[model samples]
Target: MLLTTAAVMSALVLLASGGAWAFTGWASGRLDRIDPFGALGDRPEDGPRGALTFLLVGADDRSGLTREELDRLNLGRDEGGARTDTMMLVHLNRERDAISVVALPRDSWVTIPGHGPAKINAAYSFGGPQLAVQTVERATGVRIDHYAEVNFLGFLRVVDALGGVRICLPEPISDPRSGLQLPAGTHVVDGAGALAYVRTRSTAGGDLDRIDRQQRFISALLEAATDTRTLSDPARFTAFSETVLQTVTVDDGLTGGALLELGNQLRSVSMDDVTFTTVPAAQTDFTAPTGESAVLWDTEAARELFGRISRDEPLAEPSPPAAAQAGGAAEEPAQAAPELIVPPADITVQVRNGAGIQGLGARADEELRAAGFNVPVPADNWVGGTVEQTVVRHAAHRADSARTVAAALPGSRLERAGELGDGVEVVLGPDYQGVRAVEAAAPDSAGSGGIQAATATDNVCA
Candidate 1:
């Protein structure tokens, strides 16, 4: 997300100034000479005035790497040119208050313009940026206004030029596959280390976990890069710019002039204002038709999130605190109630008895019904464990539902119960107690079983 901010700001400033245009021409000429993706073609049509979009690609190529460094990084064959490992589309509102960057996993199964359904990253390899852009546009229905690709070598150079970036590690991270080793704590990572950190995917969560770490690192990098110390130092700024400019390949529209203007526009924005989140994904082991096991994107949430960005909107904020903290509060009589949208009944509310007592399910059901949900039937069997807590289950598609359920049961143990087909399910734990309801109907189908639809219609635009 921080990278998105930096990338966008860089584009705005560089493109608005004539220098950016010239730099882009030069960059394009260089890329043309390489022609790694084959012959370059005419550019996409620039849309009428509206939101500005940028597609940031992180390539895995290490052609610029030295033999010693390649051995150090454990990099295999020289990939010749670049292969995009990460693809993110960032949409900035015309007003610039809000920004959204949607990350598309490299392994996602998508239909390419000419190449049928293939790994999303293959589009870049098959036809280069033009094909990659077309593929993403068709997949998400979001038009990309510009593009930028950062090779691994370039990323390292920029990181080194920025004097390294500071990153916080909650636990020791070691990935022999990526040659990244760090102890638990805050560590300043140089360009090579940062690249390894961002590219690591051998941990428990795999690529998803790697993306989360990358997002955090990007946030830290943005904060560091925008610091007065870095920005005010001409030597540092120029070095950073040159390192970035060399490693980065941008569309004709993102010339140096545009980047300068963008930087000026975003001068007032702070690091805290920028946020990053991945498109919701299901923890699935399903094999693609190609027989490769891969995590699948939750199509519903992914589409909605991307649609918002296409319209230049900020992500929906986290659920309100009051709603989350309302658990177990005594009901007030004849008092004016704040207007808040109640999550649909279809949202599964799992009642778990954390109290380690009998009749907990009954009590939980009563509490849930009073909270405006139609309580589902309490399971006959008890969910026994030392870690006593209530849990909720909704399809990965029902992100809103998950948020609502989590808010309703604040401070309780919450774990993603994986993907569900339709409705939400609340399983009462043995510790649960209070009034009981036999079965609660889903909110959407009036009595059918399915996850609840999103209740709020607020535009994603911040």
Candidate 2:
């Protein structure tokens, strides 16, 4: 009798597992059928083997919201049309050891294939997901393996089902417009609060800062949703799946066995294994032909970064030694310039001699030259007595270059002198000589100087 009971229990377990699998398959299929944009209909043949890319879009439309939801959330002016406020490309590598989430700013200006230059979000409005996918693919040279678009209502529901998410706030957030009020530090955010947090863009850093927050929030959500506790709760999983299906429109390739297989492969990945980064952009205010302020892509850095993704390589981290190596050092032998990499030539560095000692500007200029900066003339702008810090200046249009320069000088404090362009200006503070030595030796430890060559080759606005 005991053996018979074990057999019956095993069969019941198998049946339950099979049932859940069937349900997920059905839900995924239903989602594919509801793709009003027909973005998923085109399946590229060149997709990486066992790898998947999902263009996850978060739309601002609240049409699907119930009257109570609208009232409770205080959503105003139910704009009947949809516009994607958030765009993320989620890459599941073949080995699943790493996942890359690349966020494309909604206000980014890109060529829309048939529609000339336009806001990236406009691609969806023009030709729906198909045009958006095409624009992204053309821009990044990475094909879209799958697609998923979620509305505001869907996002709120998912957050609610997850039993609230924990968010780390560096400062108190009070956005009356979005109805978000939260104290500083880490706090548990519910559905409405999560929505507001991800959607808020009025803070100091604007859209870039908001994207960073959204990435963090999504990371937390992924952790909670994939937790063993959440997975074990069949009722919660069913509700979550239903909510997601009802609101999300996915590509055909993302349905049925494809999605189930992808999910199974990703079951082991944790939040820590995922990395999210915004595409590098010029720190300039782009005035469109229509006089609208739009952001332009930092063509050089962004292209290299995306190329690495297309090749399944990890994103390059700043190597101080590599920077120093590219700058040239008498102690180290120069190697061959890296292939398929281009460094910008119009780099400018401003050297201010703050050291009380004489000839500090000349010395700093020499160090910069050794570190590969083209300095036209050294200036003696030592307004402060005894240099205490170093400042690097780059035009807002050249922020990426400033970041690259700052990375080479890791220990030195970086002050943004938003007055220079495609250039690096150095202020010789008290510790100028020490900082120079530290940065000069950076290239020795960085392997082959290939990464530096890559950075140098990257054009600011391409």
- TM-score per prediction, in order, is 0.66, 0.64
lDDT per residue (tens digit) for residues 1-462 in model 1: 112323433333333222343254454344312222233344444443666887877666666778888887667667576567757776667875545555677777779877798888888789887788878877777777778766666666667888988765534677887788998566788877876777777654567556655655655566566667876788987776666566666766654455556655655554434545566554345588889876576576666666667656566553222212133211111112222222434333545454456666566667777766645556333344433444554332234454454455544333332222223445444333333322322222322112112111111100
- Give the per-residue lDDT of model 2 (tens digit) for 200-256: 765555676676566556556655665578668988766655655565656655456
C-alpha local distance difference test of each model: 0.55, 0.56
Runs off by more than 4 Å, candidate 2: 1-24, 34-47, 66-74, 317-462
Residue 86 of model 1 has an lDDT of 59
Report lDDT (Cα) of residue 258, candidate 2: 58
Give residue 460's lDDT in candidate 1 (0 to 100).
11
